[model samples]
Target: MNIHEHIEKWQVEDGVHLFDKIKLPDNSVLIDFGCGYGEYTISLALSKKHSTVFSVDKDERMLKIVQDKIESHSITNVRLIKADGTLSIAFPDCYSDMILMYDFIHGNTQEKLPIRFKFFEEARRVLKPNGILSIAPFECEYLRDSSGKRRRYSLGMLISEIESYGFRYSESIDGAVHFDYYHSPYHWKKLNGEMSFDYLEIGPVMNFYKQK
Candidate 1:
């Protein structure tokens, strides 16, 4: 299956639903970092619900894919950029309504350690006071497989790191991470009460909000 279908196989369509939950005002601008194939960005901008939605990624191939999608669908509000996903997100200060790192938080690679913090820092820079930064990594990463062969950050640990960036806690919904939040039936079913997080993890994958 293609990446989209592959992703869909593991989520519940609530990636967008979670954004809807963010509750932006009329005509808000959104920055979708690591936006792949422009699935969420295109569908969202096509709704004409935001003032502008910036779709950015470092991959030229993906940018072209998204470009074709926008052109074919005749979507006009999205501004696609072929920029690095972590650094060079160049929007003005306090200019965005929200920033989304949908499933990219796999952990900082060595090359990104220097610029890694910039992702959230830049989001903080461009976000309006009381704006939102929503990060949804794969939930499975939080726990080991039944046999305990893998290692992922615990929900509590992820929260502490984000808090270090100065974003206060809000609330975390009991839901799947990016993997299942988009389209997995069995995954979501397995998730029923098995994993839960606060909106803002004062302590993990909780929904979070900015402090005013």
Candidate 2:
């Protein structure tokens, strides 16, 4: 499918339901960290018009795609920010009500772990006290660390890591849709061919609250 098809699938179908399941409060301030192509960003903005959504990504090209969608959809609630997720977020302390880190964490190399820790620190810094921090580790599995030793990336391990950064795990939803540069199950039905499974990728959507 093309970009248009992907956008429709995300904004109209999967992404909307996913956000709804996550129960994003209306009129809350949200930041989509490492927002790729603004799939979740656009979906959330359209779903909750009263809310302010910040679509942040380091790549300008991806932000441009989001911008076009925003203009086409006449969406006014989304603000685009170009920033590296590993570094500081361009927001005031305790600013946002929630932060979404979907399909963003992977590769537990020694070098990458520190960067992720920094990102988590930023997430904690920008979120309001007791604010929500939702994460979907789409590629959570066995990974080789810098020592060349295999480490299993389980939900428990991830929860512990985030907890160490001052977040308390609240809840987790299983079989959460993981959207990225891949076709959804709906795409296969369009071609009169059923996909082997429901979704191309599914993972746990873990919600946490920032410690005061």
Candidate 3:
């Protein structure tokens, strides 16, 4: 589907309602980390007229797509940044009111624990004194073993990891989230070589607040 088509689908699928649940602040700077193709970026940008969004991604191609969509839709509140994958952020300390980590944390390598630690540290440093961090984990597929069996984690496990960095669990919406293409929608073929489009799965969205 084209970008417009995807945006249309999102609107029809409770995108506005889901964003409303996040309670993004107006007249504030927000960051969408690891944003692919600007689905949530665009949604957040248009959600509040006074809010400015920094859409960061490591992929230049995806950044370009975001730029194209922003230009096509005449959206001026979003700034696209090509991420360097480093723990350091160029912004000043306590700069952003909100930081979004959606469907991308599972991509971390299990061996590189320090890098992950530094990432949360940097996130805490850049977040405003009372800013919030929102996360939407992809699925259990990201937690599978070598044999493809799912490794389950309690909500406390996820909460403890983030809280260890000095954040507090605020609230969460545990239900099916309608995903845009970059987060979901995989195509797989059946044993008979027939193609199927019903391959993507949805996950829950969790929110956390930074402690002073």
Question: Which portions of model 1 show Cα errors greater than 4 Å?
Answer: 1-18, 84-86, 107-115, 139-152, 173-206
Give the per-residue lDDT of model 2 (tens digit) for 83-162. Answer: 95447878999999989888876634454333456678889999999998988877767644435555887778878879
Each candidate structure's TM-score, on Cα atoms with residue i matched to residue i, is 0.67, 0.80, 0.79
Q: State, as a TM-score between 0 and 1, how close model 1 is to the true structure.
A: 0.67
Local accuracy of candidate 1 as per-residue lDDT tens digits, 36-113:
666667645654454688888888988898888778767788888777543656889888777877666554333323
lDDT of each: 0.61, 0.77, 0.70
The superposed Cα distance between candidate 3 and the true structure at residue 12, in angstroms, equals 7.3
Q: Considering summed lDDT, which 10 consecutive residues are worst modelled in model 2? A: 107-116
For candidate 2, the C-alpha RMSD (Å) to the true structure equals 4.6
